[model samples]
Target: MQKQETTRIKKEDKVKIIAGKDRGKIGKVIRVDKKKKRLLVEKANMIKRHVKPSAKNPQGGIIEGEGPIHWSNVMLICSSCVKPARIRMNILDSGEKVRVCSKCNENIDSK
Candidate 1:
């Protein structure tokens, strides 16, 4: 089995798609699947599902929703730079690890 790798991306972070049909699109991170190394970005990588009639849904039909995209395919958009940039881990004086934007050298973590 493949080991689950850690990701710098987190929920609510803005990201830009670097690859795939959704390339160049930007969206907020909705969910993260560490086991699959995939992210569910809002309004990105949309997929359709055929749902059968169930108690929850009296009318069964097609459903459109965001699909999981590989984490490597998206780049985090730096809040300071307002651009998609690489992230590096930084250890602050307080010993708290935080993500730093490579382009602007700004802390990605919100206070």
Candidate 2:
């Protein structure tokens, strides 16, 4: 079995696209695929899906939505600084690991 890769980014985290067609775009991470090292960001990497007619949709047609982008293409946006910043894993005295913003040196995880 393939092991899941560790990622600094998490679901619901705001991120800025650094590389790709959506470069410089900022959006919230909707999902994280650790194994694929991809992220589904809100309003980024828009894609069109041709949906067939089904009970869920009476008139299925082209649906536009966010598509998965490579994790390396995005940078975490630091809440404290309100900018896309690098992150470092820090182990607290309580033995809990937390993500710290490289620019502001603030905890990324909310209390």
Candidate 3:
């Protein structure tokens, strides 16, 4: 199936995990992968990875890092409401588009 190229959750957006083991976790969006429909939330959904010793590192060990979570598993937190909320898109009279929070009707995106 073709994935949507644009996502409501953009870089630097605060989001709350709504499902899976990381449910209820809140974190900022570190990255957005539209092609894979996944988002890497900072300090959330952490996973351990084993890395081999390289020239940069004298020892190989396991490290914990944030893992990418599905877009569907997270909900954008409305700045106005300070809680997980849905997004609504609308155009202004000036012909500019804005993302609005469904719960508070506040413009979520400044740009």
Candidate 4:
């Protein structure tokens, strides 16, 4: 029997917020929780949480941080033209696969 691969998005990918209070905000994916289908985006959808004192922090206090947002609420942003566009996979001459921006036909990982 052959093993199957999970087709979930990965970290460091650019994404744009499409819903919630932080709609339209774009940021790079810092982390992904596949079990929860939530993602932590850099500088996007920030929230405040109060913490109790512990060994690490003698004086625990309120901290501002980023919260996980649903994957359905975000659209992948293309690195090619630096815009929020749909993605389409393509094969290069060297047989390498790459994602392309459906709008600009440019390579997403040109950088």
Query: Per-residue lDDT for 3-100 in model 3, tens only?
Result: 54557888999999999898999999999998999999999999999999887766978878999999989999998889899888889999998999
Clashes per candidate, residues 3 or more apart or on different chains: 0, 0, 0, 0
Q: Write the per-residue lDDT of candidate 2 for residues 1-111, one digit (tens) a residue.
A: 433356789999999999989999999999999888999999999999999989988799988999999888899999899999988889999999999999999998964
TM-score of 4: 0.78
What shift in Å separates residue 39 of candidate 2 from its native position after superposition? 0.4
Superposed by TM-score, candidate 3 places the C-alpha of residue 51 at a distance from the truth, in angstroms, of: 1.2
Model 3 residue pairs with clashes: none
Worst 10 residues of 4 by lDDT: 1-10
Maximum-TM-score candidate: 1
TM-score of 1: 0.92
User: Where in model 3 is the C-alpha error above 4 Å?
Assistant: 1-6
Candidate 2: segments with Cα more than 4 A from true spot? 1-5
- How many backbone clashes are present in model 2? 0
The residue pairs found clashing in candidate 2 are none
Per-residue lDDT of model 1, residues 1-111, tens digit only: 443377899999999999999999999999999999999999999999999989888799999999999998999999999999988889999999999999999999964
Per-residue C-alpha lDDT of model 4 across residues 5-110, encoded as one tens digit per residue? 3223469998989999999898889998888878999999899999999898789998899999988788887766777787677999999888788999997765
Q: lDDT of all predictions, in order shown?
A: 0.93, 0.91, 0.89, 0.82
Worst 10 residues of 2 by lDDT: 1-10
